[model samples]
Target chain A: MPHRTEDIEIGLLLEALYQRYHYDFRHYARASIKRRLLQARSHFNMSSVTALQERVLHDPEMLPRLLGFLTVQVSEMFRDPSYFRALREQVLPHLRTYPSLKVWIAGCSAGEELYSMAILFREEGLLDRTLFYATDINPEALKAAEAGIYPMDRLRKFTENHQKSGGKSSLSDYYTADYGRAVFDKSLRNNVVFSDHSLVTDAVFAEMQLISCRNVMIYFDRGLQDRAVGLFKDSLTRHGFLGVGSKESLRFSRHASAFSEFVPEEKIYRKREP
Target chain B: MSAPPDRAVVIGASAGGVQALLALLPSLPADFPWPVLVVLHVPADRSNVLAGLFEAKCSLEVKEAEDKETVRPGVVYFAPSDYHLLIEENGDLALSSDEAINYSRPSIDVLFESAADAYGERLVGIILTGANNDGAAGLAAVAAAGGVALVQDPAAAYARTMPQAARQACNAALVLSLERIADYLKGLKAE
Candidate 1:
């Protein structure tokens, strides 16, 4: 299969990038890597992939731009209303048994998901006893996640999503509107520590009862996916739950037999009690 | 940044959706090349039978979207049946309390626009069966931004108004039958 030679050039460029910056995307799936390279081309307006790669490898500052292009960030608050619902109904009860809890929202891009989980924990009578670590590789997203400010107009929709996702009270109760922005309640962060971490190239930090990685694994190849799943498997406590995106599964995965279906329909799995 | 196109797929649904999705999703197999994001607008409440149903039907791993999560391929991420889903610049997920557009917070527009901004021409937006016209304008935005715009033939959609609105708003690439739409996506992976 002859891939566009431009793809070959981009592959070399990524290798060059790793050599210089030490960021390893060599394990990321080729399609996504190819896609990100294409996005970088347009951002720089080069004639072809080779030109784009040439310029990026030569210019040091351009690496950040390339990195941004590579990480096509997408996220939301309390995204799948039901996964949290399941946590609330099924998992939270057991979590409540602990005197305190350590939860990790791995690959938390801009922090909306962490905030959502925090809100859930707060409402579930666990916020005071909870400690959350929202980690991501993108520094820009980490800063925004730490700031916790979002477009004000989005609050109404989020409120609706919140209500529909089994939110116990008015969504308005979570944040205050100022001008055109919704500044989330500062209290939500009291227990949350937003930092920089990469599922691709970093080591796991803590054991957690719930690790909600959502859609972060799609960019990875089968090997990297298994590595991250292995990290999640290692990070989770006994019978802890691992939640992934709707289209992702443990089936046919290297880690497939490691977990059991808890809410298989929802993509929620419990680490097999080994 | 001079590379050929990299296509990504986005899907939106609402109202009588569980069944609609069950019918539509089983059509998408696992190992579909591009990443697909599903926004199903279920009223904010306890959601059930969604992730599970799709999990069983679709070969891809089907689960709800999470905040700040990056998009992944061969995976079908449904909007958490309540909240609106969006894309972040860093390629992570963005969940919001942002007010609803078209009367729904997890409005199809929110997902479509965010995805449009992120993926641009590489993005493929699909407005599936839904009661409201939430995804219509957003689908147009995707088309206008150089993304591929596809809608289930309104006549074939479980909810026709939304697809009709999409066709009216944009120069859609394909107005496909529900089952045919699946075939079209399969072709994308092959490409």
Candidate 2:
């Protein structure tokens, strides 16, 4: 099919999806969505995006299978060392005021970032006091997150991050590299409760001292971003901190007024009274 | 009959991406069977010219990723500036602002490693070039998770250090120069 027709088919398919599935992707930006659908058109061995959408609407199995292709998950353990450093240097002091801590790692695909937090808590002597809730909508990724088995070899690089993030101990002490993979110490993830939660469809469940929702808001539109931010603000205790991805900020959001910048460079913010 | 599952190719580039992407993307045949996901490290906050840069280069199709977008195999997926583009289990694109890794939100490691987890053996992870040791560990994870790992030849890469880092972490099942890598991908059902 010509490129123009392909794009047209994509729009129609999205409409069909909204009507049939009741999943509102209509508000999502177009170029990327169309690009993904166009790829799907060929991926499912269909002739066009419209045809691919048609199959998904009728075939129960197809939607879930196609759902697999639609998801683009990329993350690592201790991804941004600086954020952890900020948690240690600045946020920890403030967090110590509370008797116990509730830390949420939202959209924690496969749990790398959550485990990183676990390690940080353990090192900071906050692990016992910390109760982590790692949530994601992806079941497969969530299962992996619960398992806490990261590739053993990535430890070397994560080790560098650990060092740069002002790690106090040798990075190797945390995990044992066995079976050509790094099995992180089970003790670190003990307090972690990995579950399925959606920022698009879910609401606040608990009061948290720190909400580490990195890399999640970028998928949401401005409205959805605000909704999620509002939830974060609602969930956080006063003076609680929120850490977002560097590319993401609360600078212009509705909730922007509710927080003061903690380590602005590291994208850490503290929730203020609304 | 239903068409075959589109082969999805995710390309991770750094340091010399402008040249590498231009060279590699053009080599991919027009109407290739899978979408290509490209992550090239650029200075954060700058406009990533990749979409415009590679729009005409021998194209299956080229575009940047967006939040909550579904990903397909035939279209090429490029990481936008300063954001980590991830795959949801639903097989959709989820853009992230969590933080930077190796000083990059759209770090090659972030993309490759996640894609590795998402696609498993069906996935192919390619590390073209870069100065930092960003994608090496991720590529190793990809290979470990049963995805094929491709590294451009350090000798030929504009930035040999990045390729060498990747090569060190994994055996680098395939090491090729621009032309050879291009040929290898062209022969693939998906990249």
- Residue B181, model 2: Cα distance from true site in angstroms: 29
**Quality class of the docking in candidate 2, CAPRI style:** incorrect
Best model per TM-score:
1
lDDT tens digits, residues A208-273, model 2?
A: 999998766766666788888999999999889899986577865888999999899788999877
**Window of ten residues with lowest summed lDDT in model 1 chain A:** A1-10
Off by over 4 Å in 1: B1-191
- Native-to-model Cα distance after best TM-score fit, residue B112 in candidate 2, in Å: 21
lDDT by residue for model 1 (B1-191), tens? 32322446888776556666676677776677777788887766544457777787678888777654566767777776545677643465555443356788677887787677667777889877777788888899899878888888777667788777788888755788777777777778535
Look at candidate 2 and tell me the lDDT of residue A258: 91
- Write down the lDDT of every candidate, Cα atoms only: 0.76, 0.76
Once fitted onto the true fold, the runs of candidate 2 whose alpha carbons sit more than 4 angstroms away are: A1-24, B1-191
Expressed as tens digits, the lDDT of each residue in A210-234 for candidate 1 is 8888867766666788899998998
